[model samples]
Target: MFGWVSGFFTYETTKSVVVKSWSVGIINRVAQLLIIIYFVGWVFIHEKAYQVRDTGIESAVMTKVKGFGFLNDNLMDVADYVMPTQGASVFCIITAMVITANQTQSKCHEMDQKFKCKNDSDCESLTFSNLASGKITGKCIAEAQRCEILGWCPAENDIPIEHSMTEVEGFTIFIKNSIRFPLFNVTRGNIGENLKTLSCTYDPVNNPDCPIFRVSDILMYAGEDFSNISKKGGEIGINIAWVCNLDEHVDNCKPTYKFTRMDSAFKNSVVTKGYNFRFAKYFKSEDGNDYRTLHKAYAIRFDILVSGNAGKFHLIPTVINVVAACTSVGLATVLCDIILLNFLKGAKQYKAKKFEEVSDSVSRSQSLDLHECSQKTIKREEKSSDDSGAYSIGHQV
Candidate 1:
């Protein structure tokens, strides 16, 4: 217990010496240089280890599409082509649609030729699910030789429809984007001056500051043709990237836009080829009966995706990286020490000089006690001898 108590306050000391060896010296210096380059050049200069990072972003987007088209021998304006007649971050303009007008709730005519049967026994009663348009009525239509279902009358036609609105190639889309870096307290937008934004279109070389984009140009950039995709419809992605270096001027923090085709082209395959959805317009007649016009809308969907990160100088990371570099440098010293004490010709001598055994406090105290006891015993014997001689002389007298 006493030894442990004393050891708690005691510190082990080491002696420092300089050893000159070409092989060890060269290896050590080379390791140090590599570490220095990695830390100073790569980490500090290239990666900017001194800076902290912020990935949080706040963004808003508004888009407007303008174009003209003709359908069913009638001219359509921008409002007719654009859905909902309002601007949004994500919007679609109708390139093609299959209309099923005057649809009412009644027995529907089954169009599948395979579903044709001689009688009710061949038509199995089935429930209506999302995949199927209606439930089976277990009846066969004599004229059509197809099974009759109790649902919307005159079921939608399965024939493919192709309507090309190639005029949409001239459509112009104005995208307004505002992004903020909360941590850095910086805000940026794609728009420059109001006049420039209104007049100029986005051109990588000439007018990069403009936010207005042409639909044809975007399709071209994504390796697609507007006329080819206008009939079947497809999806296009708009990516806005904001890479900010807070150390530079804030004007350099503007967003860059990129285009990509998200949906597969029609030439690839017949299955899952294009983008389309069903929508209905309902109205009440004079007799107070409800009726709806079901329309299968095919259009190009533009999805706007935004991403970015901001970085600024900070002290905590800088210190941490510096300390890590220094710690790595110590590994070089360790390598040299291993070679000097275990591999070289004079390794045995070096090892002997480097390491020494130490005695514990208990063992040292016991050794001192034994030496004192031996000395005491020798003195007592000498005193006893002197007394015996004096007594013998007295007896002789």
Candidate 2:
């Protein structure tokens, strides 16, 4: 029990071994220097370990388009071509339209050629045929070989007229975007602060602060042909990036612009070709009946996307990273110990010096034997002195 208690209370400490060779010293110092450089140059300065970052950005965007074009013998303005003319961020510029005029509520034949059949029984093979002008009447009229429908007389032709609003290439777009970082309480906009954005067109090298962009230039930046996209209508993206280092001047945190073709993958799709939607304009006839003109508009859509990260100096991050850097420097000792113990020429000597052991059992046994030997030697000396004094007295008598 005593031995167990003594063993349990034993103290252990680290052994320091100073190696005084050129190779080992050089290796140790070089390892420490490299560790210091890595933390200072990469972890602290380049990565900005001393700052706190916010990526949750709140943003608002508004856009406007301005241009005029002559299409199908009609003068078209922004009010005519721009869908949802309220200047929203995501808007479409119509390039082509299939107009079906004077559609009244009556029975009509489907315009789709796939619905054409010889008899009513032939159209019966298509059970769920809703692609007609309206609800199917379940009869194939002999006059028209297509299936009969019960609404909108004189069915709309699915064929679009070959009218491309090529003049849209010259149109200009103005974008106003505002972004905020809630953590830092900073708000910024893409347009110039002096309000000169209205008169200037955007050029990467000349007028980067302007929010205006030309249609052709946007397509050029996205590597798309304006004429091809205007014919069938496709989606384009306008990306605004606001990467800010809040430690610097606020003026230096202006937004950067990028263009992308969003619908490039489905450009050649046969089933879902391009971007189009249908809407109708109603009119009241003199006979008190309602009639309408349906328009299927093919348009180029633009989506404005905003993204950003803002970083600023903070005391918590600075202190935490500084402590981490200091703690990380101690790794050099481990690296040097590994090289010295396993790979160096005098590895045995270094390994021996770096480790030491003290056993209590061996020390206790040696001390007990030494104490017993001194006691016996003292007894023998006293006995010899007594004998010598007795023999001298007898000889003198």
- How many clashing pairs per prediction, in order? 0, 0
Residue pairs with clashing backbones, model 1: none
What digit string (tens of lDDT, one per residue) describes model 1 on residues 125-190? 433323344677777777788777776666777567656666778889999899999998998998
Best by lDDT: 2
Per-residue lDDT of candidate 2, residues 180-299 (tens digit): 999999999887677643878888888888899999999999998977887788999999999999999988889999999898889899988778889999999999999999988889
TM-score of candidate 2 to 2 decimals: 0.79
Best by TM-score: 2
Off by over 4 Å in 2: 1-13, 17-37, 195-197, 331-397
Superposed on all Cα atoms, the candidates' RMSDs to the truth, in angstroms, are 13.9, 12.8
**Model 2 has how many clashing residue pairs?**
0
